[model samples]
Target: AQLNISGNVTIHRGSETLEDSKLVTELHNTEDNAYDIIVTENDDESSSSDEKEEDAKQIEPNRIEEAFQVKYQGTTLETFCSRLKLFHDEWYQQIKPYAPYLTIIQSSGSGKTRLVGELRTKGIYILYICERHECSSGYPASTPYVQKILETIRDYKFGALLSIAIKEIKNKNWSAEEFWNIQIKDDHKAECNDFWRSVFKSLLQQKKPSSDSRDENFVKKLFHKASIVCCIDEAHELLAKATKAKDDETYFVKWRRQIRDISWVGFFNILLSTSGKIGNFLPPVTQDTRSARSHDFVIFPAYLDVNTMDVLAPLAENVGKEYDYTRVVYLGIPLWGSLAQAGVSLINLVHLASQKIRNFSKKNNDHLANLACMACSLSLEVSPRIAEVDSLIASHMATALGVSLDRTSILCTYPSDPILASGALKGIIDVGWENCLDTLLELFSRGVVEAGERGELVNRILFSKAYADAVRECFPDSPVTYLQKVPLKLFLKSLLREEIDGLDELLNRMGIDEAEIGFNHWTSLLATNQKYVESGGMKFLTANLVIEAYHRHTAFKMPLGFPVIDHIIPFKYNAGYGIISIKTRIQKKTTFGAKDISSLIHPLNSFGKWKKGYKILGIYIDLGLDRENAVESKAELKSRNAPQTRSKNKNNEDKKDVKNDYDQIIYIQGVGSFKCCGKEISERLSKILFTRPWPLDTQWSEFDEKTDLKREDVIKTFLPLVFEQKQSLVDKWQLI
Candidate 1:
């Protein structure tokens, strides 16, 4: 052709590979401003795999300074901002001239604080009041008291408002600490007065700073003129405090009313700023009030929503593994029968499951695993109580849900006494049940579980509904329904079978060997043994089976004529006895005598031995064989040689009543709550009271050394009605 060498050329002389090695030269002298170049060539040997992978991950220089992604309610920051009214535009059109009644509404953690910061930077002076004293993570554990607000204003612009407030507090010789002291006195009044004055002054001031304005005086004036936007974070706290008025409790009611009135007056002044009408303040909205206008109110509360959840999820994932929300619905199976019986939401279920895994890690002291499990558990919504009774429930939920132990760590938590915070749980659970509602709400807000609405739980059981239905389907017999007439022992045994199995088996197998301990642990066995008897397997099996055995063997007495189950070392030593005794009393199905003594009765001798002291009165049995040695008072017993309170019908009839019909071992008498007595003292007294089989109206026969009466006889007579209760010894078991 025309010999176009520029288009193509051959560099190799040989014909073997001249096509593969092309060499060409351009004939044109000028270059175009913009041109596209393309060429095809055979692939060369690639870089090593490791190097290639490294290069792939390397960030390019051009990608720097790109805007970070901001997620809010499943929307981008720019998108959200586009929809929200701009601060300046909003102030000018809706808030500015009103002298400052403005309300901002948004879920918590949604850039509200940042927005406030921006407004301050733009020279829009504001007053901020959060519901809580500080953020959840902030210290000293409560919202800042009203006193702090009165001391600082200028520093609000620097986001050092709290710090400045603290400084102001010190300047005024006050402390935030004093507010929470047990003894709140004059200091509280002073603080309240100071806070009131500060708030009043802040609301009333109305001026702006200028170039030639006196600096200190000008800031003060500007602060006064600024429209106050009392931002209440965790507004629920305020709402809660306002609703707790009692009948005839005018002080708190008056105080709350006054506060509302003040807030209303201030709000009206700001609303009528341009019109200069200070009389028309808005009414304060407590949570009890269903509705309130938001024209000038600003609140940021801990509310749960998808966007907040999304932010929380990633953090949760970082702490643990990602879990599908649906999986939580079926958590816990073995013990609860299914997730339905557990009555927990999916998130809560996951949290409970995760808690169990963490518990093992903590018990074993595996630092890394512990940390991981802890993080995972927290991610799933489990708290830090490593080993709690809730583990049983949590483990069951986890098994049902099919979540791995590590992932489900968050589900397990203490099974609060009340099902929720319903007052219906009065005697069924413990006192102070209402205090847990706040914690429950916090858990709900954190996505642990849905809170109860009104009086009912928000979530229903998912799979074990049938099991629960079956339970509700069954009804107790008339005999069983009347729990009081039934022997307490029988009721307790049935309860044991239902609630505690191992104890039931052990108690069944106990025989004489278990009795060797003299029913020392009865308090511990109280719940288990009582439940065993209550469910109805057999009769004569009270929680007191073990203690009754001992009662039959010994002889000591007290005033009430019922066996006094006292602590050995006394609960006051560690307060354990009081807790144990109350727990035992509630759980005991039969009288106190038959309850397991080992658990209930610790060794007071342990304390005594440690104290290097021996018994002042040597421990002994009141056997009638020593009748001749018996004595009552030094005066009465010296005169005769016979048993005290002997009946006129001294035949076997009275002795038969003592031997055959007698139920109680000894009588008990004490004025205060007996959280701290010992078993030895109690048992000794029981024998004394039961041995003689004396009546309150009976008189002494012989109070001498030759008589049956001895020095152990202290009381002469007592009432019998105090010892009355259900009489039974039914032995049964129930699985709880």
Candidate 2:
């Protein structure tokens, strides 16, 4: 009777292992076969145990011990085995009948390969392939770069046996000199090479009657009998081809389709697994015309849900327990940009800001910090600075309500005290408190702000894995003193000491006080200007307030124009006095003043054009406009601003007698820009996306060529640049 072993087996038939000696010769030799056998030693097995164990005491070799179990964190065996078993059982059941193409969405260090290996050990033949040169700590063999997987399959069976034999010979502890001394014949070497190929080809083409068969070949034959599961790792990278892959189409996609419809094999089990990504990759499923068989699709996400961040907490904890827990200090500044330019923006802003703080603290110089403080103050004064305030209030409300707070005045305001300015910081920017509240609430509905019960505000950039940690790492000792102590009052004070006093105070001292006096009344009062405060201050104040109001009101809930430029004045508004704007439209077809619309299109006048006597209303590209008399030539614009001139000739009648009329023209006089009927194209696109109002999905690539706005690069580069410039300007002028 043949006795079956319960535990691991050990090979102990001691035949002196030789140079390039096959493992099969060491084991029991089969009829007309000379193949190798690979074995692992167990703790209880001896090196030579062929004789009766009762008569001879078996001694295990010290060099060989039981195979070690793969452990988590280098010590503890993970308890995830039960969960893995359950998941695998469920998966096997669901995918057994149909040809299932699965995408397993998992993050790094999820033991994906090990689980697959264990499944293979359980008799499920999985043809595993991974990306070439894609190295991760958990997996040893990265993906094999073999062009053809069929070659790998053939070699896996026969080549593994050869490797085992070669390794055994190499382990003899003989030095190179002694090994070379032993003569091996050329015929013997040629025989070894031929044996390798013959065994591989025979096993791969298992239908052929075998003259001699090995144990490895038997396993391959068994595997080929049924549908094999091909498990691919890093499937995302495979699918994403920058140009073309093996063909004009993406290799991974094309290969997947080919594998799915392999006519030679009838519905072999196909499984594709990947970590769920929020990107476009998977191609639409094609219909099967031949047989009634079709590929079934399944997707598994890495993350559980947006609301719960703790679903993967256990896995994270397991890995982090050994390694240091990720320490992060999130700086939640409001910003967004293109994907390509994101890192640049974060580097420029985060690193530069951090270094500025460090340098200031080290040098005991408060000038730079004070400058930043002033800018922050000005922004606070001009804008509501709703992000921090609302999030703070929302957090407080959640505490009071004993639930997660939502973004509403009820959560973001003092519930007991109705007026917000009473407790929190206050400044009006022509935008009413009610409207500000609505804006904040709208941002919440859009999922920009989350109601964290804890002090943690959603740092969209930081919380996002792409930049947050990397950025934090980039700035090690970013002293928080500047931002931490940055109260609005202190910021305003810094503006006075550093910026406003040096310039405007000198102006006031020089009796350019008319301009200086007007500036003070219009902007925030610098401390130096308070001494020379005059009665006519209110006139300058009214003008500035009106202009600011025009811009705020016009742009509110309205669309802007293409190549959007909000020009203040044809000339720069530097004289410190406020500006005014005006617009005029000619009467319908009756013809009007010189038909001179030339002054409107000049780059200088393209922005702030003010006319005293004409009707002011908005105009659109109306089809009703009289095209017969309409003049749209360069010569017409050239003569438009010129003073009254007679018609040059009677032949110029068609040009000179071209009658003109305007429907309506909207203008914000000195404010220099008009607001139209829709949201900004960029903003509209964002709303359609992030909010998902429209059925069409938004992509950064969509606007790459369509708009002049390097939406991607501009957001990344300009936002932070504009912030710096405006901040510096505000500081120098003390406009907080």
lDDT by residue for model 2 over 534-569, one digit each (tens)? 533221123344343222111110011212121121
Candidate 2 residues lying further than 4 Å off, grouped into runs, are 1-70, 73-97, 100-102, 108-111, 114-127, 133-140, 143-145, 150-230, 237-736
In candidate 1, residue 315 scores what lDDT? 20
CA lDDT of each candidate?
Answer: 0.24, 0.26
lDDT of 1 at 172: 51
Report the error of model 1 at residue 377, Å. 21
Best by lDDT: 2
RMSD of each: 30.5, 29.4
TM-score of each model, in listed order: 0.21, 0.26
lDDT of 2 at 438: 36
For model 2 the local lDDT of residue 454 reads: 10
